[model samples]
Target chain A: MERTPPHPEVSAFDLQLVLEALVDPVRRSIVTQLAVTGEDRACGTFDLPVSKSTATHHFKVLREAGLIRQYYVGTSRMNALRRTDMDQAFPGLLDALTTPRAVAR
Target chain B: MERTPPHPEVSAFDLQLVLEALVDPVRRSIVTQLAVTGEDRACGTFDLPVSKSTATHHFKVLREAGLIRQYYVGTSRMNALRRTDMDQAFPGLLDALTTPRAVAR
Candidate 1:
């Protein structure tokens, strides 16, 4: 039986990759948008005011950093947050990073 | 009656810089070592298994990323985690990233 390249194993390097990937504000916004949508979304769907080239660069950065998994679902490439891989690598890490804290009354 | 550089100013970009800086495993290990020491240590202090050039490269990456502040303290250079600037930029985001979790029984 042929074994598929089991999802790239997670390590401290992978953790770093994910952290660095989400560090950009634009990327963070993309992730927030993805999370709110609750499913994969096309790169162009985000209303980022940057130029098309910049947007593409940002998406490429996000993809290379391992923050999001992108696959061709027909002509459009779908992008979704890699929450499962991230959670497995560092449990509760993604939640803590993305969760919004309430302001003091 | 003049002000120093006024701390380069923190923003989302700065957050990205910090995140990218700490993403490397070698750099992360250095940060952990610094945190445990609680006092700035010389670059030569850490017994990194990498070559001198590689160690220097790692230190440069850390410095450029804004995760740690390096300054010349006499004949030796001192390094400390930029916890204050980072905390201001994203609140408890750093703690969430660095805290280790215990495995469940």
Candidate 2:
């Protein structure tokens, strides 16, 4: 039997934790991709520029922050944005954070 | 001569930097207070539990992240939320971030 990783309950979502998790560029990119895809993506599907370990760390941060839900599918671990959970906690926060903009910096 | 601190232009606002600044609880509290007050506040006015230096550090973080603007008023430094800039950059992000919540965590 495959064990699922623990994630914070939607009601237990902490704004600070969520913000922290999204602060990193890689994590923000991941969230944006998930938001656009609207589906679970294998961890390896993300075109992260970091090493596998570093990528794993970013996934863990997102999961612990309750920003994403992860589950195992066969040999691959798939991740999806917890959009409903985030919306419940912070309202339009996810949309604002993920909306594409011409970043001046 | 009173010199206003430099802040990233509204068009230059970066989501990652803003999230990084808000990730800190103390900084978040400061932003919340500013949001509620809708006016500039003196640095000494915030009821932060940290040391003066720590509070100063947090303020600098907020200012540099383009989340807030700071300027001198006589001997005191006043800080104000960059609401216009933030909104221009992230739309409803500020409201979502500052809205009072039950915070199940």
Candidate 3:
């Protein structure tokens, strides 16, 4: 069985933490992909240029920040953007942040 | 004579830098205050608990991120939220981010 890392509850999402997690170009890319897909993607699916360790760190940051949720599925850790939670927490934020042209580096 | 530090042009506003600047609680507070006032405010006029140097650092971050504009007026460095630029760059971002309860730490 795959172990799931701890994540913050939607109600406990910290704005600062979320923003910090999304500030990085790589992390923002991850979030943008997830938002665009609108479906949970396996950890290995992202075409991140960073090493495995760095990619793991970015996922951890996003999970801890309550911006993404991770769950195990047949030994694969799948990640999805917590769009509903984000929308509820800060109206229009998810849409603005996920705008491809705006966030694209 | 007061000197205004250089800031990014509106067209050059970058999402990563803007989000990074707003991720800090103190910086968010400064932006929030400026948004609420809807007018330019002197740096010293903010009731920040941090030391002058620290506050200055935060202001610099905001300015460099293109989230705020700072201008010199009679030796006072007045700061104002770059609402127009932000709105044009990332529609609805400033309003969502400046919502008091949402970004309040």
Candidate 4:
């Protein structure tokens, strides 16, 4: 897998990267999974219907956007939502994006 | 001087486009200016230091990302923040992003 060194220019308000990173339903699903589990999960753990290549692409987008942090923990790349960074940057923006809508039965 | 017709696939939650469009400080300045003015502004009105071409490109990015609505209202194109649409999609997100932080002297 590819890794990018941190750039000082990348700040919390990099809105385009943030937006583009989260545009996919699958990525949203991943976020929800992280939130629900309340813990970081390995990149391979997500049961996405798409192929591994697509999953890798989504993870890369999220990582590049600074929404999630990925690092090698053994052979697996563990992923965790960068809640603290996001909350500090935009403060409550992530909560709005991930809130579950009430469904009427 | 190009206009894109409305597309059904264009939803407010298209996060990548939204993030990319707002990444530029000039665009954020435009949004803040729109918020401060509390009214729609013409494309030519924003006194950005950048060239007019760059301003137009920024506007196009915002428009494509569904962050702002643009329409011709005479010779100039009028622009307004799509606050309502953003609220519906990710309620309270814009407020968080645009909130003025308290500074102590």
Per model, kept true contacts as a fraction are 0.28, 0.74, 0.83, 0.41
Q: Model 2 off-target regions past 4 Å?
A: A102-105, B102-105
* DockQ for every prediction shown: 0.22, 0.64, 0.73, 0.25
Name the better of 1 and 2 by DockQ.
2
Model 4 lDDT tens row, A4-102: 434222353466566556557788778778876779999889988899889988988887777888877778888888888777766776786677740
Poorest 10 consecutive residues by lDDT, candidate 4 chain A: A4-13
Q: Per TM-score, what order, best first?
A: 3, 2, 4, 1
- Scored by CA lDDT, what does every candidate get? 0.65, 0.84, 0.86, 0.71
Question: Looking at candidate 2, what is the lDDT of residue A99?
Answer: 74
Q: TM-score for all predictions?
A: 0.59, 0.90, 0.91, 0.64
Model 1 interface CAPRI class? incorrect
Give a tens-digit lDDT track for model 2, residues B1-80: 43876777876676667787887888888999999889999999999989999998999999998988998888899999
TM-score of chain A of 3: 0.91
Worst 10 residues of 3 chain B by lDDT: B96-105
- Which residue pairs does candidate 1 place in steric collision? none
Higher-DockQ candidate of 1 and 3: 3
lDDT of 1 at A92: 61
Q: Residue B55 in model 3: shift from native, Å?
A: 1.8
**Candidate 4's interface RMSD, please?**
6.1
Model 1, A16-84: lDDT tens per residue? 556666767777788777766678998778989788889878877777665677776566667888777
TM-score for candidate 2, please give it. 0.90
**What is the alpha-carbon lDDT of model 3 when measured against the actual structure?**
0.86
Q: Worst ten-residue run, lDDT, model 1 chain A?
A: A1-10
Task: Give me the candidate number with maximum lDDT.
Answer: 3
